[model samples]
Target chain A: GAGVSQSPRYKVAKRGQDVALRCDPISGHVSLFWYQQALGQGPEFLTYFQNEAQLDKSGLPSDRFFAERPEGSVSTLKIQRTQQEDSAVYLCASSQLVEGGEPQHFGDGTRLSIL
Target chain B: AQSVTQLDSQVPVFEEAPVELRCNYSSSVSVYLFWYVQYPNQGLQLLLKYLSGSTLVKGINGFEAEFNKSQTSFHLRKPSVHISDTAEYFCAVSLDYKLSFGAGTTVTVRA
Candidate 1:
């Protein structure tokens, strides 16, 4: 795809269930970021990956959230023992440059619903 | 640390009328500012960015924004808006690699 791609546009799970979301960044993109957007709020950074290295994961709300990018091109965000508060839109973005100022291209995102 | 605040939660405008979305930021060190627009059920698209050199930045879809250092603001504006311009806009600031975003402003353009 020309742009970032995310899998499972929508997902529904009950409490205590685990969910994994996938992100396929643009070809050759060196930087990938994941964010969570709650209803009526802006997207908040969850983690960032530079190539295959997990550079920053400070924004992650808790240890239940885990993300990995072993190949630097595809990434996954997995949540364990999901709670209702974990329900939100998970967004993935990729940028060509490793620098800070470059604009990021985003995917449509996976909207998760916890029931 | 960096944070962004968008003053208006929602703004209603008529077609062909001017519209402005206010955004303010707080950061001790140098920062990069950005504006993004998200349509319903879609991802955010970059509207503009202020990295260096220029305070006034122009973006696609005829939208522009001004970076104000003293006021710590980077408000987005358009001389005229169309129905297609109706969407949610977010303002963000980056101190390092990660970005902190404001709540967001919903713009509704009525024909």
Candidate 2:
């Protein structure tokens, strides 16, 4: 892909329901990241993956937030028992280098609305 | 730990006029700085970054920023802006490959 790709550009779920968002990183990208952006706020880091290994998950807000990148190319973010506060944009980004100097390519993101 | 602070919540500029967005970061050690722009209904796009070397960094869409180590600031500037330049700007500091971002500043370029 020319850039990071995300599925289901928008989602609406009821309280207590579960939602899954998917991301397909660019070809040969070595690092993948997930972020959450609330309305009128900047994107906040949620998790990071170096290849298939999960290096950091400290940014995940709660136990209900989970992410996995089994193959290092595609990643999924799943939220269990969605709450009203969960309504926000879920973004996925990937970079070719593991170093912090390289720029991360971002996807359009999935806007989740919990009602 | 690293964190970023965007001084302005919003900035309004007319087309063909210059604009500046202020940003500051806090860290005990050396850090990587970045500026990202987000347009409506879209994802964030990298404006520029400061890793090392020259403090003046240039990026796409005629955007540039200067990284001042003394003041711990990375402010973005554009000599002339277009209506298309209206977007949300974010300042971030990278720590262990994770980015800590500021609240963001909304730039509205009017014609």
> Could you say which candidate leads in lDDT?
1
Model 2 per-residue lDDT at B44? 92
Model 2 spans > 4 angstroms off: none
The candidate maximizing DockQ is 1
lDDT of 1 by residue, B15-101 (tens): 999999999999898899999999999999999999998899999999999999999999999999999999999999987678789
User: Which residue window of length 10 is worst by lDDT in model 1 chain A?
Assistant: A96-105
After TM-score superposition, what is the CA distance of residue B6 in candidate 2 from its true location, in Å? 0.6
lDDT per residue for candidate 1 within A26-60, as digits (tens), equals 99999999999999999999999999999999889
For candidate 2, write residues B1-111 as lDDT tens digits.
Answer: 888999999999999999999999999999999999999989999999999999999999999999999999999999999999999999999865898899999999999
Instruction: Please give, for residues A1-115, the per-residue lDDT of candidate 2 as tens digits.
Output: 6989999999999999999999999999999999999999989999999999999999899999999999878999999999999999999999999976788999999999999
- Backbone clash pairs for candidate 2 read none
Report the lDDT of model 1 for residue A52.
98
Clashes of each: 0, 0
lDDT of candidate 2? 0.94
